[model samples]
Target: MNLNLRAAILHNVSDNDQSQLEDTIVDAIQSGEEKMLPGLGVLFEVIWKNSSEDEKKEMLETLEKGVKG
Candidate 1:
């Protein structure tokens, strides 16, 4: 059985509305499970890929601050 984690994650969440997506992310984080990291990463990848340059820079800044703070 070849399980593609990224594909699976994307497929599951792709149809979700904004509120559903936010809930998924919130639940994943609040659960504090290491297994959820890859799913979150996949979500971030989609968001990053679709973002504009300004959005990416803002995200980077937010990430940097998050890492520091």
Candidate 2:
């Protein structure tokens, strides 16, 4: 939706230890397990706390669109 919410989601999604978190998200979407989306917020927070500015911006844009619609 808005930039702040998008940034938040990106922050959570980027927190996962696994490099495949993005893939996992895609799989979840394909499987229709939409409930798992909330966990992305946690991952986003983790990532947001530790990420570089460039990475944060990219992820923010991507997750914002994903979460918003």
Q: Pick the lDDT winner.
A: 1
> Residue 19 in candidate 1 has what lDDT?
100
Off by over 4 Å in 2: 1-23, 61-69
Off by over 4 Å in 1: none
Per-residue lDDT of 1-69 in model 2, one digit per residue for the tens?
Answer: 355765665666555656578786677668776576665555656668899999989988998999999
**Candidate 1, 1-69: lDDT as tens digits:** 999999999899989999999999999999999999999999999999999999999999999999999
lDDT against true structure, model 1: 0.96
lDDT of candidate model 2 versus the reference? 0.71
Instruction: Look at candidate 1 and give me any clashing residue pairs.
Output: none
Worst 10 residues of 2 by lDDT: 1-10
What local lDDT does model 1 show for residue 3?
98
Evaluate candidate 1 by giving its C-alpha RMSD to the native, one decimal.
0.8
The numbered model that scores best in TM-score is 1
